[model samples]
Target: MLLEVIEAIRERVGKDYPVWCRLSAMEIGVEGGITLEETQVVAQLAEKASVDAIHVSAHLVGPGRRPPMAQPPGTFVPLAEGIKKVVSVPVIAVSRIPPELGESVLQEGKADFIAIGRGLLADPHMLEKVTSGREEDVAPCICCMTCLDSVTWRDEGIWCVVNAALGREREYELKSAEKPKKVIVVGGGPGGMEAARVASLRGHKVILFDDGDELGGQLLVASKPPFKETIDTFRQYMVGQVAKLGVELRLGERFTVDLLDELKPDAVVLATGVIPFVPQIPGIEGKQVLLVSEVLFGAETGERVVVIGGELVGCETAVYLLQQGKSVTIMMRGPELATNVNPLVRVPLIGRLKTKGASILTGVQYEEITEAGVTVRTETGERRTVEADTVVLAAGARPNTDLLTSVEGKVAQGLPVGDCVKPRGIREAVEEGYRAGLTL
Candidate 1:
């Protein structure tokens, strides 16, 4: 079977030299998956057939299968190691391995070589930077699954939030501007910073204004959730990029109409980000009710907590709070939790939620918040009140576009990017921000 396929490939290409095809050999499909021993059989066969090399890879469909999650960096290292023991030809392992980890894998004799996918997308010159001993300059991939999401999440097209050049390699290239323009960017969020980074790199005199003394916008809050430490790494990378590119950051400066008028910049970018949506439910005035943002920031909450909404924010918040020894019950109007989360992260999240003893009530209708707890109506019209001392609001977010609207038409070109245009995740924010910078 292997020889037949190899001959067909060689015949098609008509190459004098080796074509050197690669195979997963061991794939974990959405339903039925192959085993390690099975992979060994095919790998040996390929080597006997005079194959030049073997590239080890693993495919994951989603969660709720046997593994319940897609593996991360070095996920196939063990598999590659297993194949190396059986096959004689060179073996290569590929996935999320970073430069340091990939080096260690080789030094430890795990695999002959390592290949990176998302890491390269995040930092196009990763090899150059690491080789030159300037690893700090490399933008790190946080493994947020946003790049993969560009495909699974309705074919949004490929774009990396960390590195805007991934999708638009030619358009977003950092070539100096033909004529440098004075650019003023409002907000220091992901979008705002990305805009500043790109514009300044393009030889624009860029100044970024943010009310807070530090950067990161709402990423500061979002990064506080459990297993979200990588978000901070992304934040630090963006901040560093803007600074390294010589973007004049005006931290602790508010952007008002008067400020814009005074600056008289050639172009302006608005990326003020979003505010949490507090649903107008009865008894919302009670001090016991808190927003998901508040809970994440260490606001005082009772032992028994009831979280509203079951989206990515709500589900993750539940896990965050539960890890702190708070009993959690997640109630949502939708029938599912983290419905939009990538299957890789969502599978383990859901599986952990089940075993952690946290309560999950889906298809629920929120009635009101009470001092004791929350009153919810099930999909079947069953009114059930879950007793709790604290209620968290994770309904969603509303874009903070005041800066966007106020600065409209006041400058040579005013652009509303990121959450100012629409409340979205970091992916949209960074892509739009990069485009905004390129336009200037």
Candidate 2:
């Protein structure tokens, strides 16, 4: 598979484009996989193929496999050394290589260059900081994998928890704008707040409006989970940015087209977010059914809980409930679990869930929510019931596009963003909002 991929790349980009093959040195305990010797052989083959570099690291996938990030940097040094011996071209060593370790690898001739993925994300200009003798400015990655989690919960793409502006380069700016205009942003959520901040920074008169008292849309609910306080940092930073940029903020004011007409700004950005999907399952309304958002942001639940849907949100909510000492059984109508989740976070999370004894049932349609638990029908003509005290529905969400539809073509310069445009993560929301703000 690796050779095929490399060959295809070579075919398209030509031999001089510097195609490097990155692979795992060893799977640790896994059998019948690439060993250190095999890795060196592969590196030799790549060198023969005129590959630019051979990047080696430890990789582990599938259930019961500990990720490379979980292991120490020393564990991969031997593998790097082994590959370096055979490969004539530059060899790249990866897996949590700190500056000290990177320096040692370079000094000992184990590898030509140290490749740091998350490390660079933790500080995009890390090399600049290091070269200028200002290593203190380089933000160190905690390796907590919250950045991985953000891809799942916040949909903000890959980002370091410590570095607020990692994936937001396209959204946040420090330079002055060539053409700035007055902008009115509705909703103080991630999208709205971001739009206001970007517009104001670009020398535009900006006003951010939100019916809610505080900023942060669905992010507020996401921050409630354990070890997810880093999400709040983004919200706080966005709010602070708006204030620092002198973007006018109006809280607890409902947005209307009439109000927008009154403001008569240069542009209007709508980021109203989304509404929870209320399923019409039998006895669903009678039971204490709460949206995943409610359960995530609200109080604790009963000892036994049944989560409807097994997507990323449902899986995370189930994990959160299990962490709170509640018995969680997730019911999904699909064959797979957490399909929407990022592999980096999902792999580890599913492993942890297995250790914690959480139950997941897929390929089963939710029939109803009874007094005892949830009744589900399997695809194989089997009826199974799971006991639960609290039933949390995380089926999905509906875009709150009513306002967008109502105001469509009504305003001279109208733009729909965030969940109102489509129910997605903060990354899409902020990106769309930033684009809308820039257009203004």
Q: lDDT score of model 2?
A: 0.77
Alpha-carbon runs more than 4 Å astray in model 1: 7-16, 19-38, 59-72
* Residue 71 of model 1, lDDT score: 42
Estimate the TM-score of every prediction.
0.90, 0.69
- Residue 148 Cα positional deviation in candidate 1, in Å, after optimal superposition: 2.9
RMSD in order of candidates:
2.9, 7.1
Please give the lDDT score at residue 373 for candidate 2: 86
What lDDT score goes with residue 124 in model 1? 82
lDDT per residue as tens, model 2, 383-409: 878888899988989888868877777
- Candidate 2, superposed: residue stretches over 4 Å from native: 1-116, 119-179
lDDT of 1 by residue, 154-183 (tens): 596776768777877876676778999999
Q: Residue 40 CA error for candidate 1 (Å)?
A: 3.1
